[model samples]
Target: MPTQILKEQLAISIRMLERANHIDFNGHMSTRVPETDFILINSAAVSRSTITADDVIMIDLEGNVIEGNGRPPNELPLHTQIYKRRKDVQSIAHTHPRWSTMFTIANIPLRPVVMQGAVLGEIPVFPKSQSISQQEIAEDLAEKLAGHHIILLKAHGAVVTGTTIEEAFVRSVFLEENAYRQYMASQLEYAHSLEDEDIQKTKNVVWQPNNIRKIWDYHFSKL
Candidate 1:
């Protein structure tokens, strides 16, 4: 198979993870393989800062091994379910960014008032349940993710997906930043929260999955 496209995508995925500083012993990045039900995901336990294109592992929809030497993420089903449910999606990013994690612990719905927050809008909280497993998390996210690109999982972390790695990466970074700001704003005597109308307008203007593709392509071209 022609690997030029795959290689480029992998490099972009790695760079996105690195730039966001999302690396840890557990955090990971993954992208869908073109024209197939496979995903190229970073191997488990790899440092996000040092991840190279060759460090990516290709896995089937069922989390079955395909190629590459290292272990695929235990959350493989998370990416696969999204690909199965949303054909338009080309990539998925899962991270443990600090601020987003704060919201996860606080059990709050992140509101959008600032431009970046507006770009993200509202993020729903996922309640943990015995029935909720990794395989079913994507479907749960899809239900609540109708107009949002980011979600805060209760006690888990933040999950964001996009048509390209860059889009996903940007959303992830902004989501965490917004969460941090919101927390700080709450403590101040007076902080401006977004009005309902403004939030709705942003949701209307930039929340579509297709818009993510357009934005990323423009950025990718520039880079």
Candidate 2:
């Protein structure tokens, strides 16, 4: 809601994801500044676990640093272009989670297998392997992400969007958790996805703003 608070949340979410093994040295998170054209995001060079509010920097929609002393993330357009296209997305998370990335290489599709998995439904995989450092590449990624809250990079990582950073972070958590279960299920002889009727039961239950806040609070408490 406030710039100071967004910085703190970004720092906390980055640390949370880093510890959860969702993000490594390569991942980042960003949020839109209300009533402004600027976005606040974690710096590229900072260690994910030790970042502070001060390490979060402000950049224009075009990826130019407007404040703070930290260097911009090379995949900055990953956040900038999405913010430009998806006017509904207020936050984004780029996570290279192990289980999720594993699915990118295999033929299996991520599905709503677990209880909370219904929240993510079926995550799409974007067919790009290169780094999203340039304008055109990021634009393509954004196009691939149209109308979806989460999309996995071809052989790299996953991107999640939300109306708030908490939603994005929680979805990142769900993405990995769902992918982990999906992978585990694959190890068995056979597995089945939740039926459309089953998913319908939980979709509204999990996607509610209050429920998202509850999940975020649970993770934030762990942080």
Candidate 3:
């Protein structure tokens, strides 16, 4: 029953991300199997919008499929490396959202442009434009992602990590939203970021369990 629920949550997260345009055909999401070295992720061929629990596969840290028949994503190392590095991170969302990707190639730093962005603080850029297909590259990316919730891959995309699937999914959405707003604001004048005090105060209220649940529930309902 627990595994079934996890699969459902994975499916819902994929659908929500696709609907929000955080990902299309190229992105992926995964969750570490509780108390296990396995991860459940969407299969390579599965489109985010049409993915079901059956489309999800279980794989080991080495990117070897442990269960399910579908092939894992080529960027499987990205998920495995983060899980190996951050034990507290239970879920991950690796996407190529337009605005976030734009910021990466535009050489603009993603800062706290609004209350939602405050929860994320300063986002880091991975400084690499290539796909993270090698173990070494994945490790380097993970190192850059250390102590950060979101990291932008130069000309690639962004990766969001959280202690829960909902948190990771919500962070992915907000990352894109923040980037979109910042991009728009840049057109008018130099956009200012929230001060540290404002970020801390807003994060205290916005990142609470109840608030995360509210956003998670609302997005899941759309799936």
Candidate 4:
């Protein structure tokens, strides 16, 4: 994809995340500059909802700003280190949704109770509560991420990775949605989760390109 298009998509995804209440003032999103070590991410001071294509900054794998104005996110290492460690991840989203953050702080496990939750069989929770600003902490977080696409930052937020902006954005949204349902279910006397077979049956279909595109379109329309 073109760099201009990627910037636009990134901005749209940020706005959509804010609209869905996945991020407030303290969230960041980024995408790899196709075939390059550089990434386009939101500025540190910009609110997710107010981000525009012009507000996105391009930085190298070493965290050096290559283009655009303003400071990159303070958690720049969080995105850069993941790009260095995971060759498959093309986009990433770091946000602090209420329910997901609640689960993170409470140290509660997230179960695949909903169909969408199936994609996240067992979301890992990073035990550290400090900011992942340093290179070493970011690398440690990436190690905890292992082969998973999403991970919870204890008392901080959550991070979701994908091969595309739509994939990351959709997964982030669903992760929060699942957390919301889980919180509500906890209020009841009992709650059951989907069986492994059921989750396996729907996993492929739910993440298919057409389905992801549908979700992307729906959310993008809302922006």
Across residues 1-223, which tens digit of lDDT does each residue of candidate 1 receive?
A: 3454664566565555555555456666777777777788888756665666677778898888789778887776667776777777777777767777776677666766466687775677767622233666667766765656666667767678777766777687668667778888878854476787787787567666686666555544644
Compose the digit string of candidate 3's lDDT tens values, residues 1-223.
2777888899899999999888888899999888789999999999889999999999999988999979999888899999999998999999889998998887978888888898886688999889887889999999999998888999989999999899998898788888888888989997789887788899988999998889888888777
Clashes of each: 0, 0, 0, 0
lDDT for model 3, please. 0.89
Score residue 101 of candidate 1 by CA lDDT. 74
For model 2, what is the alpha-carbon lDDT of residue 64?
85
**TM-score, model 4 to reference:** 0.97
Over 4 Å off in model 3, which ranges? none
Alpha carbon deviation, residue 89, candidate 1 (Å): 1.9
Pairs with steric clashes in candidate 4: none
Candidate 2 whole-model C-alpha lDDT, 0 to 1? 0.88
What are the models' TM-scores?
Answer: 0.78, 0.96, 0.96, 0.97
TM-score of 3: 0.96
Root-mean-square deviation of each candidate, in angstroms? 4.3, 1.2, 1.2, 1.0
- Model 1: how far residue 1 lies from native, Å: 12
Q: What is the descending TM-score order? A: 4, 3, 2, 1
Q: Which residue pairs in model 2 clash with each other?
A: none
Model 4 error, position 2 (Å): 0.3
Candidate 2, which segments miss by more than 4 Å at Cα? none
